[model samples]
Structures are given as structure tokens and as C-alpha cells.
Target chain A: MSSEYDTTETLDVKGQSCPMPIVKTKQAIDGLEAGNVLEVVATDSGSISDIQGWADGTDGVELLEQVEGDDLYTHYVKKTE
Target chain B: MSTDNPTTSVDDADSEVDAAELQALRERVEELEASMAAVDDGDDQQKMTIVATQGSFDMAYPPLILASTAAAFGWEVIVFHTFWGLDILHEEKSQDLKLSAVGNPNMPMPNALAALPGMDAMATKMMQKKIDENGTATIEELIDVSLESGVDLQACQMTIELMEYDEDDFYDGVTTGVGAATAIQHMAESDVQLLV
Candidate 1:
């Protein structure tokens, strides 16, 4: 079930290439409040690793859960202190 | 269109032609010289480089697409694959790549719809065919183009070991070794650093 802490944000980078998804996600996270959560949806599978790396690279965000299924990889990340 | 030395040379021995013909020849010579100078101004070429490390199926397209296009500009390009990015290097290319429906909120179908019987299998097959036709080149093609364009290929030893991969695990030009600091220093000197 979706909870208050679980908010969804979709990023359509279909026609676009790689790094773009990561870059767009970075911009999306930047616009949110600290501690706020974001659920990113991307057509590019690269976004999965890209987002994970982005969070690790930033060192301030937290990757709460990564639900990987056959075709989708729904990731949950929270903005942290 | 002034000629520095407008002299009829020995090569112009046919100067005995009528004055009208001589005048026309001079005008043609002047026009040719002017066009030559204009051509010289447009001959210089600009250069650029792109480094793509992401190797997932969907991730793979970014590097291949960017590399092929950037190379089209006649710019020097180098694609480095390390860690999971090495998925593009998987021998069983089919298993190495996936269109990735996981976490893909933008996917048109809901989880139930996606899982509606054997739809998932069909979707995966469809995506593969689309990418393949759309120039989602195979790992072999990726490595070949990089070689033809003089792309320097570097692999991360740490990542390789962590993933329990070996030399046979990589392709021809790949050299096994290089860490993050190295990538940073290298990219810092590049015109573009594209992390897929």
C-alpha cells in the first residue's frame, strides 16, 4: 500500500539517452524539501543504477527500498539530513 | 579581385589571342583565385569526446547512441565499462540486457497488466526487437566501433573482482584496472564526461 512517506514522481526520458535520466533525477531531487521522499519512474533501465549511484554519490540521500520485478524496478529514496 | 602580379606568364603563351579574349581570361582567373581563398577559411575541424560507462540494456543505448553520434562528428571518443556497467559485455548478450520494467513508473501498463499472463515475456521480446532495429547495437558492435574510432577502453579491476569477473569476461581492447580517482582525473581533462 502507498503511504504518506511514499510519494511518486515520474520522469519520462524515453527518447533521451543515459546520463540524462541521472541528471534529470538530480534536478528533481534538488527541487524537493529535505527529508521528502521521491519515487522515480524511468523507461531507461540505466536509471536504476544511475539513481542508486546518484544517491551514493551525493551521500545525503537515502535509498529506502528497491522493488525489482520482471520489467520494472520501482525504487524508493528519501531525502535525508 | 586584385592580382598581386597580373602578368601574362609563359604559361599564358596564347596571349596572342584578341584583347577581348584576353580580358575574359583575366576575369576568370581572378574569380578562381577568390574562391580558393574562401575554401581555406572553412577547412578547420573541431574535436569532442564522450565516455559512457552504463552497460544495462536500456543503459547500454545511451553510450552506444552517444558514442556513434559523437564519433560521427569525427571527434575522439572513449567508452569505459566497469562494474555492473559490464552487463553489455556479458557473453550471453540476451541475458545481459533488459528493457527494465522494474521501478519504471512511466511504463504504460500497471503491474497487473504487465503481469497479465505471458505479457511480460512478449513485452521483453518486443523491446529487444525495437532496440535491435533501432540500432541498439550488440556488445560486439559497441566494442568494434570503439576500436575503429580509436576509443580507449578501460575496465575497473576492483569492480571486476567484486563481481568475480576475469580477463575472459571482457572483450579485446579492454584493460583490467582503474579506480574512481583515475576516472575523475581522466574525465576532468575530457571535454565531456557522460555517465550512463
Candidate 2:
């Protein structure tokens, strides 16, 4: 997943559900500089929509890509103020 | 000559009226578009308000979950805990809130069995186990997440007085003794208002 897109940081939130994935994602994204890409790996099936919806509604962040791989959901998000 | 061109005069008059109306409509569209663009770029944070009326372990999850989730989405969140929901903010009661099977249609057991002594406690224990197994955030953890995410957790003032709960019974970040009028004002402006 890292090979697909250059990521500044990767957050793995496996075995966590509802709001935790997004909560932790927001926290991680907050630490990155503008234009830095964050890669998030989540086990929750809902993270796909959760992260996408969160990024869509939230300012200063953009979801670049989302990939589902072998029971894991991966998302590439960019900080765009 | 004028009588012969009466139809042309009517057509000219209609064309002039249409031109004026079209210009007015075009200006209105431009104003609307500009305002819409401003909204898209402005700091218009979405707001969500929830009224939590139940204190059961099961019922407690919904309001907190939605509040934290909305906060995660960068929306302003407010949760008003009233009546039995006061247990959710009570320092000790929050950890001990029970899931009563009695009179609950969702409980798989028959009503008679649900009414048996220790049934509610057993159900609550089982639910807690499931929650742990699912890796779901506990009520305490959710409260912390909500507070850290800037969700406003309000405890109803009337409920506090009626239940005789001390001011210190709630968690640290809670906005205790908030009035219904205050909650109503928030709800009125909230983009989403829920009764959970």
C-alpha cells in the first residue's frame, strides 16, 4: 500500500470499531503538515465509508484513495488547507 | 400604417418585457451562486444535537457514538442527558448502568423469565462481555473521546435537582446544570437534532 502512494505517515487501527478509526485518523492527520499524505489501515469494514465521509465533510483534508485488501481497509488522505 | 403593424407592436412590447425579466433573473442567479461559493469555503461547521433520555447500557451507546462520530467529521456536537440518562454522566453509575431485560421486546428471553431476579444483572454482564469482545469503546471511554474531540456533554439541571445528584457526581469535562432552554436554543440551530 505504501508503494502505491507516497505516505508521510501510516496509522494502523486494527481490531478497533466505530469512531475509533476516524477519531485516530483525525488525530494523525492533525499532526501532518499541509500536503502531507497519511495512510490509514483499518480492520473495521465501516472504515471505508467512515473515513471517506469524514474527509468529505471535514475541512483541510482530502481523501485520495481507499483500498480493500485481505480483510484490511486502507485509505490515503492528504492534508489540504 | 400603425394599424397594419399592430401585431409587430405587441411582439416588440413582449420582447422588451422579457428582456427586463431575464436580466433580473440573471442577476439573482449570480447572487445565489456567489453566496453558495462563500458557504462552500466559509467556516460553517455542521452542528448536531442529541437528547439522551435513557440510561441503560445499551441506550447509552447511541448518543455518545453519534456525538463522537460527528465530532470526528468536524461537526459541532452537543448531547443533553436528561431523566434516566443522568446515569450516563454519574461518575459511579455510568460504570454500573444495567441493561434491563424486563419489558424490553428486544430481549430474546420471555417476559416471565426476564422478570426473574438477577436476570437484568445477567443480561448486563453478557452485554458488557460482548462490548469488550467487539472492541467497542466503553461509556467511560466514549465520554473521554467526546470530550477530547470537543463534543459538549450537558447534564440537565432539572434532572440533577430532582434526582438529588450532587454537582460533583459527573465527569470533569461535563457542562452540568444546563437548562432545557439552552438545549432548545442549540437544537433550534443544529443541522441535525436527535432524540436517542
Candidate 3:
């Protein structure tokens, strides 16, 4: 069975540092249509907190599922209008 | 024909004018150099001034971190907050700003390493303390350093209305209702422009 919040977009932000990841992710969010979802994978430790903070601050962006593994972070966030 | 004269000269009028202009520029440069050397040799510990622009809470740290540390190193540092970054201009709100991590699992935060079950709150508090220890200078310290070193701090007026924050919500060094044009002008005057 597929997860409820499936990945509609994938952003690879590896090896990049703080602010760049957030900046790029914000661009992604802007491009996304409401009700869609995005799967984000990153190696930066700051992205987790930054993305969550951004997702909370805006409307129609819902972080639906989160799974943290050994070396990276995987998140599925749905777009909500 | 070969126009191969190595020192091909200009006409007398143009050559005379160019020579005079060059001489004047050279003399002015020498005077400037002497003044700079005097300032450098003297005990006047002021010259460089920087204006920092911080728009968000997360965006707040880099500017403060850089400015306070720059101040510690004896460079004049100013932090200008326009929008959400101004939230930290107040001692109370600044101390309480936390990162929300439910869907944003990619904030490049060190707390992600703690990935313990429900460790986000702990991670956030720890992050705050870490930032403090890292000379992630507080808004209060920024104000103090700014005052001591003649640094000017201003808040963007338009951002104030967008966020519905009042002037009374800021610290003593904080000036509210400044326009972006002013900040842009300051940034233009600065040798560096960081968008944090």
C-alpha cells in the first residue's frame, strides 16, 4: 500500500548548507499546486527544522509524513489550498 | 602603412588636459593615502560599518552571528530587521522562537541528529542554547554592541504592517517604520550585501 501523502515532487538538496536549502525549498513550494505533495530528501541537518518552520508559517502547505533514517531525512508534504 | 609608433602621442591640447587630470588624480590619491595612514596609526578604532538585513527568524541568526562576531573583532556591525526577523528584536519573543519540524524534516538543523522519538522540543531548546554559546548573539547584545560602536538598526515599515507588530515591540536600538529604500541605499553603500 502507498502512503497517504505520496510524493508529487522530489527535491534533492544534498551537500548544500543552511538557507540555500530553505531558499530552494521555498521556490519548490511556490511552484507546487495546492493539494499536491512533495517528497524532500536532504543531508543538511538544518533543513528539518527550517522546512517545518516554513510549512507551519504558510497556508496550504501540509507536512503529512516524516521518516528519519540513518543518514538522511525523508519527508512527504502535501499542498493544501 | 604601419601605424606602429610604440608611444603614439596625442595632440597638444588633449595631451595637456590628460596630463593635468592624471596629476590631480594622483595628488588626491596621495592625500587620501596619507589621511588613511594617519587614521590607521592613530587610536581611532572606527572605520568599517556594516548593515545586516534579516527577514525571518531563522534568517535572524546568520546576521546576528556574523555582526556580533564582527563587532567582537572590532568592526562596526549593524543589524536591520524588516519582517519576521524583527520578532527577535524583542527580548521576550526572540527567546521563545522555536522551529517547527513536523513536515520540515530537512532544515539543515543539527537537532536532526538527535532524531530521538519526540525529541524535537528538546532539540529546539538545545539549539537555542547552542546558538547562544556559539556567539549567536542575542538581540539585546546586538543592540548594545550597535550602540557602543555607533551601529544603526532599523525596522522595515511595510513589514511591520504585514506582520502587525508595533514599534513598542522592539528593543531600544530598534527604529521602526524605516522604508526598504533606506535599507537598500545602505546596502548599496556597503561593500557586502547578505540576504539573511
Candidate 4:
């Protein structure tokens, strides 16, 4: 499913906990240009909801796809504006 | 019969208009109260203040962690350090802050083992190691993050005078050195206050 969208950059925050994943994701997303996709891979189970909720609250970033693989959670966010 | 009398009928009409006006005024007061309540609620939801009074390794983490996390949530966060807590802001003193296993019910080791001569140091090292292994940010790193995220770090002026410490003893990013009165004022205005 990752092959569907073009990813501009990938951030692997595998061992990080709750807010770190969200914080790093926010930082990574901020560094991207408009319309660029950021692929985030995190091991924290909380990231599934955390990233979704963060994207929901954030204005410019859109959560495109979220996939769960065994112990890893992958989120694709595109900078919309 | 009253309706048939012109004077009584005029009086009834006048009373009806007065009642309608009274009802409109009541609704207006209710709307004003609701709007004022909303303004107060907004004021209460945006600011938080935390006071740190301990300098141990375990004690240092809470304020830094909370301040950084709260700032990330777009809150106006202030962390005031007084007494021993001021040690956490000092580069040399911060490294010497140790976790004591003695009398700590939550310590993993039994009392007898924890009472050993070197147990406190051992516990401190073990805890630091575990924190690093968990990829949790160090106190210094969290302090930097909190400052970068706009969490105001303050020192107690009275404590500095009492302890005979100068401003040079503390690291950068301490923007203010204030008295307890100032800290109390901030706490009174803040929506949330925590002492750790």
C-alpha cells in the first residue's frame, strides 16, 4: 500500500514513546514543502491515534494513509497548505 | 366584566407590555452571563504553572517533562524553581543530584539491600541507565526542548539570595528571577498549578 503514493521523505521513529513520535512527526512535517508527503514509521502503539488526532487538529497537514504491520505503525501525511 | 371596562382593558395591555419587556431583559442578562462564563473558561484553559522544589534525579524530570509536553499542546507554561530545585538549573550541581533508595517505598530492592553504603549511587546510576535505554530525553534535553517550545523557566530570587548563588551559576534560558509573590501571582492567574 505504501507504493500507492509518492513519499518525499521517511522518518523512522521506532523506539520513541508517546509525545516524541508526535513531536518528531510535527517537526518533520514542518520541514516539508507544500504537497510533499512524509512517511513516518513508529513502533509506539499510541502513534496510531496520536498521529491521527494531531493531524485532525492541525490545519495544514492531512493524514493520507495509516497502516499497521505486526509491531510497527506507518503513517503517511501530506502537507496540504 | 373587566375586559368591558376601557380603563381596566388599557391597564391589562400596559401590564402585558411590561411583562414582555421584563422577559426580554431576563434573556439579555442570561446571554451576557453565558458569554462572560465562556470568556472566563477560555482564560482558565490556556495557562499552567508548575513549581519545582526538589533537586534529585527523579524529582528533576517531572517539571521538565510536564512543561515541555504542555508547551507542545500550545499552553502557556511556566516552571518556577526554588530551594533545592534551583540545583537543576546549575550545570555543576545538576550532575550531582542523585536518587536516594533509602526510605523510598517504590525502590525495587528490599530495604536491607537498599540500605547498603553504595546503594543510593547504584540506584541513581541504574535509573539513569534505564531512562537512557527507554530513549527518554535527559533532563537537560527536556529543558532545551521546553525553552525552545516557549516554556518560561524562572528562578526564585529569594532562594538565590539565601543560597548565596549568583546568576552565573545557572545555565542559559532562565529568563526571570522573581520572588514568591510573583510566583504566587502567576499561580493565581494560571488555570493549573502543580508543585513537584
Q: What would the TM-score be for candidate 3 when compared with the true structure?
A: 0.45
Candidate order (DockQ): 2, 4, 1, 3
Classify candidate 1 by CAPRI docking class.
incorrect
Model 4 chain A scores worst on lDDT over the 10 consecutive residues at A17-26
Q: Which pairs of residues collide in candidate 1?
A: A71-B101, A71-B102, A72-B101, A72-B102, A72-B103, A73-B102, A73-B103, A74-B103
Worst 10 residues of 3 chain B by lDDT: B43-52
lDDT of each residue in B146-183, candidate 1, tens digit only: 55555566667677788787767666666667767767
| Each model's lDDT | 0.61, 0.92, 0.62, 0.85
Clash tally, candidates in order: 8, 0, 15, 0
Candidate 3, residue B145: how far the Cα is off, in Å: 3.2
What candidate 2 gets wrong by more than 4 Å, as runs, is B1-43
Model 3: how far is B78 from its true place, Å? 3.5
Candidate 2 per-residue C-alpha lDDT over B1-196 given as tens digits, one digit per residue, 9 for 90 to 100: 7567888899999999999999999999999999998997554878999999999999999999999989988889999999999899999999999999999998999999999999999999999999889889899999999999999999999999999999899999999869899999999989999998
| TM-score of each candidate structure, all chains considered together | 0.48, 0.84, 0.45, 0.73
lDDT of 2 at B97: 96
Docking class of 3: incorrect
The local lDDT score (0 to 100) that residue B192 gets in candidate 2 is 98
Best by TM-score: 2
Q: What TM-score results for chain B in every one of the models?
A: 0.63, 0.79, 0.58, 0.75
Chain A only: TM-score per candidate: 0.73, 0.95, 0.83, 0.96
lDDT by residue (tens digit), candidate 4, A9-76: 99999987756777678778878999999999998898899888878766688999999988999999
State which docking tier applies to candidate 2.
medium
